[model samples]
Target: MLVTRQKTLRRFWYPVMPVGKVEAGPQPFTLLGEKIVVWKAADGDVVALADRCPHRSAALSLGWVDGNAIVCPYHGWSYDGSGTCVRVPQRPESNGLKGRVVPSFPCTVRYGHVWVALGEPLAPIPDWPEEDDASYRRIDQFYETWRCAGLRLMENSFDNAHIHFVHRDTFGDIDNPDPPQPAIERLPYGFVARSDVPVYNNELQKKNLRDDSAVTIRHITARWYMPFLRRLHIRYPSGLDHIIVTAATPIADDRCQVVQFCFRSDSEADAPARDIIAFDRRVTEEDRAVLESTDFDVPLDMNSGVERHMPSDQPGLLMRRMLIELLAAHGESEHTRHDAGRATQEQKSSS
Candidate 1:
């Protein structure tokens, strides 16, 4: 069985770029394997449309933004924010072409990122409560591309067991390789995984510590939403609260772009954003080094027994199952079936 990529993953909103990046100029982006151009309208709202010009198939991104419309460089054809071709310089009398339009996507700007839906969004864009909370200060926002599949990065973000081994140099301790079993709470949209974990604070975190005493226990809670959104909350015993909201947008089947926002309730007035971003970059880089080298581009099918699961893998397991369910609900489960069949065949051949 095979499934079209778009059908498998079109119902979710993807963060394509930072809101500031798309100004009065056209910026080209790819989402769900489709080329799109985003620009700011004269009213300052964001707009997204197919990147190609109808006249010459030239990339609209190659052209410039004129007020609220995007002008094609090849033929001086102009398109408005709604994807309507409003002008054709060569044919001034072409009134019949007013109805000619290019493809347009639903775009929304939130959390400092521009989000576009390739298809009708099944739900509203996911949100983090801490983003607007008065107690929590938004500190850092960073973006990076990973060479692994979006699911891989998402699973890594949800995996607590990997910290001891994969991040030993940064924040993990090799001697303590075991983590407590996480409590999983299933929700209508997704699930929440909660556990108490010991954290080894880096120098930057140490500086922000409210208490200088050597306390390592922190309450960790991770909330995962349907396709690829996650919010991780870390509460210290010293009344310091930290949150990380991560959205992994699929760039291709084997690649993704991740936007991360870090927030803290303590020391917001003094904590340096660069230090926090640097720490996150280091940890994500460590994960990227391993994820990019993995053999599988896509996540393993949870129902298939090819991959082993432990108590600590509950969150990732639930995530994979939920993703499979979403794809099936969207009538795109052929890919999942194909993957499972292949895995079964590989196992049988090996045995």
Candidate 2:
């Protein structure tokens, strides 16, 4: 099972860390299994570069930050934000080492997270429009890591069928376990799924609802952007709106970091942030537990018959198909090719 590098996936922007976390020092991070370094320049712009130093192959993250340059700890070589080697202590007056450079990545700060692009990005950083709306109260951000592959996390987030069974204890009602089939619309970038179903609320959430009616219908809309960005919009009958925007960054082939920002139309002062965070934490932990125990590290081919799916799995199926198409388009579908070869070999052996 050889995992091929996803070159096309690298063209999208991925969140590295929270904006507040990146201080004046050199912070090391791994995106798409590539080691990279991030730090603020003198003008307060975020700079991302290959972690390896051009000299002696040292990690630039292991060095310190000068005025606007990163100094190599092994030697006294310093590189500026533009990836140019600006200063060399051993050869200060030598212009030969001035033009030496390291790989620099495009970086931007958005939605309280620092995003980096490993290659030429197809578009700007994806964000939910309501995040900046005056009516929506932005809740505190949360971070979690899953041992599963990044694609699995995205599929899980896009899936509405699993909430009934996997989240029965937190937000799901076991009695009404069936989720209605959603209306899915394909977008230029990704797709959107909308469902009008009975919304189940936990004890904490129930207390916060303005209407304590016996029946409550909610409109749930989920949108997915190219690569690995998702936003969920839940609208209540009482005019309350809740949005969950998540970014799953691939730390490794088998690991990913999920950063979520929640927004609501209700007043934050009425619904304390602590209580909201606690409720979210419980729901997410439940999801994390199930996602980590899955047998496959990545999603299976849509037509491979590796797993069974129902009508409720329409969104997930679409997502998997989209991923396969992207991988094939980029010529990175080695696993798919490998599976076909194995099947052919098995048929020959059987004959």
Candidate 3:
């Protein structure tokens, strides 16, 4: 189904770009197939508006940012942060600006990424206590497009069974194919899962910790914030803590922008940021190759029987169930389901 059109998917905040990237000029981003342009106001507040110029249908992202408004390069049309067309070069100041406003979305900065909400979000951005602790050395890791839907990445990260195979070259322990079920607690928006898994101490681990042990148990505490944010706090036996914050921002039905940052208990001298980022890139790419091969849209209907499920799929199941219930809460499940089928059919027919 096309989750992009579902109310459950749109009523949440998604990362648009890194804080440092938007200051230069208008940046383009897509969430659930809607185009938006983000730019830093003169006052240093980051904001977003519809990417279209509204006059001649030029992409506003192709324009430049003025003091507090974005000026369209096509014809010098300018709009303020509230999306009001405040300036028109060829016409009288206020005459051509009448009713020339575009829609504006809620935008803010959190966890070092700029976020925009397409609707009135039900919850605040997920909190990161470690961010304020000051003891952890945080490193902004990666921001790039991965060739898979955001849901595919989210589901894979929560599904622990794949690591032993998908990441065998990294930290996976092939000796244990079927991992033990994790303890999961459902939260208001998403869920928290805890698990202990034996992992081979690969190149990344050897650098982080000098221990020669072939395998180490990972004490992982993972939190999923509704729609697409995931945080994992991993504690190694050597007392080193690694926290990973990842957000899979949907760029379209078949692709997503993956943003990640890591906080380590060790100093840069102990483990270089470059090495950690390189290792993480490899692990995520392994996931990308496989996910891109599958259907981008995941069926929320457990009874659909399109995909088989194993007991180890609890994390994904719970996630799917929660989203389905959220759809019903908004009373759009039935109607959205009908539309989803029609959309899928239309897409197939066209292809």
Candidate 4:
């Protein structure tokens, strides 16, 4: 029998939602694999707490905001920005509520996103170079949960060899293709991968390479963040400049939620944007089918019995191992003990 994993919510910062979505009042989301409620105080500070209301287990999200406090709808219990129960309508003249505090987390709204720190929140959120520009457009998109781990799913984006088989006719042609040799760089926070593979564009490759002509190189730069987030920057100068892809994948053990932010340059055609959207959705669906059908509940550690590597998979392999070590050292092991369904149900009822 498979044993449930230990609960270690602290270790990394979690991307909850876009800053604008969390209104002046109480807003709730899932972070660090836990359901949480956030509110913008009158002082302009963002407060986050476990969504559970200590009183009768009602969701704090259902509670209305009065000044900087969140007033629970059930029996009227009020919690301050710090998640402390300040007032109990049913029992006013009592000092018993002095130490009644909910689980509160450190949070910040930066670069159009609301991030919650599961640990001490020692560092700033990862910076995207284009986030500050007024001309940059941000589009938030999401995909259904994947059975495989988030890190594994993200590595698929960095793997050029998979394109030949996984995306085949649509985004690549692997049937009669030349081998792919990728150039990789290790950055302080993440990694950058690029390849001059002619299969980067299916249409153009067929036109130029069909006659043994030279094809252009496609520079695919993927900036990865701590835990499991990848900000992809793909530039084909003759193709498009401002094409970017950002994803936040929070793993609930083996299952993962892949949230994507697709940003386009102020100068690209509308067709590429549309194609990117369709291509991502289609390929992700294909991946979901493959992962779900396989034995996805295998161990997350490197020793788990799975058919393994080649030169092309080196970058992905190193990244996965590093992530595993990072999580272990931080005390958040790769195991799923948290019930995501319960968390979602609680949020919906409370919100």
Top lDDT model: 3
Candidate order, lDDT descending: 3, 2, 1, 4
**Candidate 4 residue pairs in clash (backbone atoms < 3 Å):** none
Off by over 4 Å in 1: 1-8, 303-306, 336-351
TM-score of each: 0.90, 0.90, 0.94, 0.77
lDDT by residue (tens digit), candidate 1, 208-277: 6644544378788888876777888988887778788887887766667788887888654556677677
Q: Compute the lDDT of residue 19 as modeled in candidate 4.
A: 69
What would the per-residue lDDT of candidate 4 be over residues 145-218, giving only the tens digit for each residue? 56665556666667777766766745566674444666777765467766655544445333322323334455
Clashing pairs in 1: none
Q: Is candidate 1 or candidate 2 better by lDDT?
A: 2
lDDT per prediction?
A: 0.78, 0.78, 0.85, 0.62
Worst 10 residues of 2 by lDDT: 1-10
Over 245-340, each residue of candidate 3 has an lDDT whose tens digit, in order, gives 888888877788999998889888988888888888888888888988988778878888879999999998898888888888988672335577
lDDT of 4 at 146: 62
Cα distance off (Å), candidate 4, residue 104: 0.8
TM-score-superior candidate, 1 or 4:
1
Considering every candidate listed, which one attains the maximal TM-score? 3
Candidate 2 per-residue lDDT over residues 1-351, each given as its tens digit: 112266777788888888777785888998888999998877888999999987799999989988888888999789888898988898878732555489999999987778998999976776467767988877756876778666676778767678777878766766776778889999866899898877577678775665666446778898888767888888888888878888778886667788888888888666777777887788888888987887534544765666787877787778778777776877776354456578899999999
